[model samples]
Target chain A: MTEDQIIAYVDGELGPIEALRFERAMEADAALAAAVGRHRALRDRVASHFAPIAAEPVPARLAAMVDPSSNVVAFPARPRRWFDAGGRYAAIAATLVAGLVLGQVLPRGPAAPIGERNGAIMAQGGLAAALDRDLAAAPENGAYRIGVSFVSRDRRYCRTFSGNAGAGLGCHGPEGWALVRFVAGSGSEEQGAYRQAGSASADVLEAAQAMMAGDPLDADAERRARDSGWRLR
Target chain B: MSSHRVAWDETGEIIRFILKAVDGTELRTSDVTEFERALLDLLPRLRRFARALALDAADADDLCQIALERALKAEAQWEKGSRLDSWMYRIMRNCWIDEVRARKRRSETFVAEEEGLAVGEADDRRIEARVELGHVDRAMAALPPEQREVIALILVEGLAYREAAELLDLPMGTITSRLVRGRQALLEMLGEAA
Candidate 1:
């Protein structure tokens, strides 16, 4: 069998019985075997050339994309108008109220809570005090990173914290830094390092920004705030 | 639609799962379908496309989020036996194109190159292979949008030639020709033995 015969055989473009006959012929043909092998190798080379993508670690944010239910919330079908704006805001307020209800009413495990805690510092109690009194006392290190302390555009005092429990942002609002998000591996739960929070991780940073009051608190401001007893407004 | 009834509860559960992750909403019974199950199952592939298209992992995930939001919003339109994968692929392609176009407008100097898109997780041999793959990616990117669409449908996606041709609204010869040219270029860049 020739190279063309093998290529045609592999493509299954040949008739079924003819394909079977070719397969049988290849049993006795060493040269055909080598040729077929090369053909398969080439096909795989092409496929793998594009297929490594499947093996790469799929970023979590992408994985979080599941089809959102239409029932969740509906935005204006058309651009907002003066008349529509009021209706839209009303609808949004209603949705927020509903979300708030669900968030509050839902029973939660220690690991996963449904809604943001208001004026609550819900860290493991002993852990919280240790961080406030001890970890906060340490100087910043590039290696032992404590993310960032920023004053969000919204006047919330936000900070990224990492230690044994993992890295997450805590901010001062009606509820104080109720662990807005705990990013896995962002920090070891060792409760002792100071790492800078990445300005990436939009959801975490956005929460930080949403709670922020103005420009970020500089290192000097952070030190003074810590010195002045780290009060929450 | 019989399968709709056959797995009504299961379908509802899957819808709930997706909804819980996306937004805290409850899906009505009428909103479930086997087509959705098929679409949700393809999330990994969609993420792969996102990573391939976006420069940074963060942006890739954002693209995936947007794509998911779009797919869910348009879920009601998907009919059974209509090739859900292809429909989802079209959605992903459109999302990526829109995002790239927006980014392009924002930054005149930006170019979306495959080399920068790699996650840098592999070894030297794999890295070399990935660079070769990057060339194929560029060659595919260089084709006319129409031809590139055909290659993605028929070749990378493994769709039947006729099905792909139909999906792209092109003649069968056009798909074959585009595929041939695409494959030939890829082989040349990677070497025949590769």
Candidate 2:
């Protein structure tokens, strides 16, 4: 048999008959037995060389893709868009929420005008009306001061409002305007006047600028959307 | 099937025990199939095979990542009641041939830092063993890529000659001959009197 026979026999690649035949040849020739021994030694050495790699912990980047807990299809995670950063009410904490004013979001009561309907934080009474009406795009002198009106990245019409009720960003949803991001100007809206950084609406507008999908709605688009009852076009 | 998983878990018993003490890595509830769990179990072995194919840990992981993506993407193509390990091996080998191997040919560099990192916690004896391992690794690298792959399949990975041959789509004689040449070179490099 050639050297390949010795290599294959040592690696158990030989069939039963071939292995037995090779064993007989090894018994006959002492040098052949030594060659077999050498082949066995090499295979053992090399197996040891590479086997430890199997024991190393898989890298987290690679492991994350197969993690059953995660949505493996999206493991690497999509890049956050600049316009949608700290905006869009997907996950408040997941986005960069460094200095946003999220004041006691949607505190519900008989006197309070915000309520949760079917798990959605709904803007009740004047707040919802301000988000719904043409007055949202009007000048600063309106009753419920609308800082800006724009469509969110999700195509929902949203308005930043501050008044006697409270100040926050509310996006129009099926149930009504949902309080997506809140300004901490609610209960403290009386004498203390819900001022932190500056006027609540100013903070709302600034936060809205960072969080808005685009520029605040132009007067024409704002009027048209308002006339159509604030439905996304 | 759960009993089989328990058997697999036994291999990771120490790891699980440590994770429990540290409150690390709780598997969240998801619709995990036995097939998926089996694939998860094969990762370490696939990584070993990947290391045998590629140059460094990072490159091997990149190759593994590509293989995993393809494996999951074409998961429906995999046959039931067959060895998933072999199927995954085929997928990894294809990834190496198609993507990583071509990329590596353009700029291949041996990384000693990876070897140092592998044995960061090694004792003196283990350090000496690591030195020997490094020698073997260098020797394997010195081989032609073809011979190196053959050596990886037969010697390092312990595939049968026929299995290696079929997996590579080469004749058995060609595969055996390549293994013999690779082993001879490796033995000589290691200064074994073969």
Candidate 3:
């Protein structure tokens, strides 16, 4: 067998038929088996040698770049017009200011599919039903999959969801469920699979770490929240 | 309608809380914030890839930082729905090539052999393991850049052979050949170390 075939076998990249044939060849050939063993040992050593870096706290300089406060300004371009001294005019001015801010902050473009309700971007269409009805701990096969549910630091309910678009963290706010953090596909994991906490991507995990007010809601608490329309009150 | 208006009152505090939580560093653009957040999670993997490519720890981190800066500046070029990690890896590989060319222009000596195996800190008990890892690292650093990258992508980073080929803009057969030779060299060097 070629060295490429041996490496392919080690990586499990070969098809079943090819793999079966390779296995037969391996059983008969000691040198080929020894090469496979060496390759496997080398791959393991490389992975383990680098594994510790993942556990290290990402350097503060790197973390600062993603810190929401450092990177996400709410509305920096609001026009600086002075308001008149009339009470009614002040109220009108405040309303206009709110509209301007919402226009900047609310999801726009293609993301508009997730409708805006009460100033929050609610998961619409399939995502809404999944959040409203689907239990994360007991997942069902669907286009959208819910991974974990927890209360946010602000006492709002938030859950991590993934679908064809990508993975994101959506939290229930006064208006509706808002998409707070989203990462385009990393091409690491497939959607619709029942991904456990351990399998969550770094972006999903960081969003959870930043927002999780407590441990993830247990099945009983989740059901209670669902029954009560996902409301904390 | 009235409830939506009241929600604005809470928005002020929510915005303030988020800003405060991030220590008052203002997010200039939504796209930048989103991109940075996504890229932040991939740093560890990127670092590991850099470690394999650049060999020296400081050079690896430098390569990572340069690639990140380039990715952020050229964020518009990134096609949505594609794998961000793969795109970043391509940028990193380009950066390494440019660095190599620049070093050649300057006629500076390339990385010292001993400098190539610096894989972060190790404890006293794992001395034997560290030595083994050191040998592997040294062997990896000795390969030509082309062969080293194929090994890095396919062997260390776990990209499929096809994916590695596409990332390197090479044919599948070339990737297989390079990988075959690279692995043989590595095995021979490792055997000597053993």
Who wins the TM-score comparison?
Answer: 3
Which one wins on lDDT? Answer: 3
Q: Give candidate 3's error at residue B178 in angstroms.
A: 1.0
Question: Each predicted complex: what DockQ?
Answer: 0.11, 0.18, 0.16
**TM-scores for every candidate against the unseen true structure:** 0.40, 0.49, 0.52
The model with the greater TM-score, 1 or 2, is 2
Taking all chains together, the TM-score of candidate 3 against the true structure is 0.52
Instruction: Show model 2 residue runs off by greater than 4 Å.
Output: A68-233, B1-28, B104-133
Q: Model 3, range A1-233, lDDT digits (tens) per residue?
A: 98879988998889999999999999999999988898888777666666665555455445444443221122212212212222322223233233334232333444432554544445666676777788887786765678788998898888888765445667876555676654333212532222221132455667688879879999899889888888998
Please provide, for model 2 over A191-220, each residue's C-alpha lDDT reduced to its tens digit, 9 standing for 90 to 100: 342333235455557656766787888888
lDDT of 2 at A52: 85
TM-score of chain A of each: 0.36, 0.47, 0.45
DockQ for candidate 1: 0.11
Distance from true location, Cα of B155 in model 1, Å: 3.9
DockQ of 2: 0.18
> Considering lDDT, where higher is better, how would the candidates rank from best to worst?
3, 2, 1
Q: Order candidates by TM-score, high to low.
A: 3, 2, 1
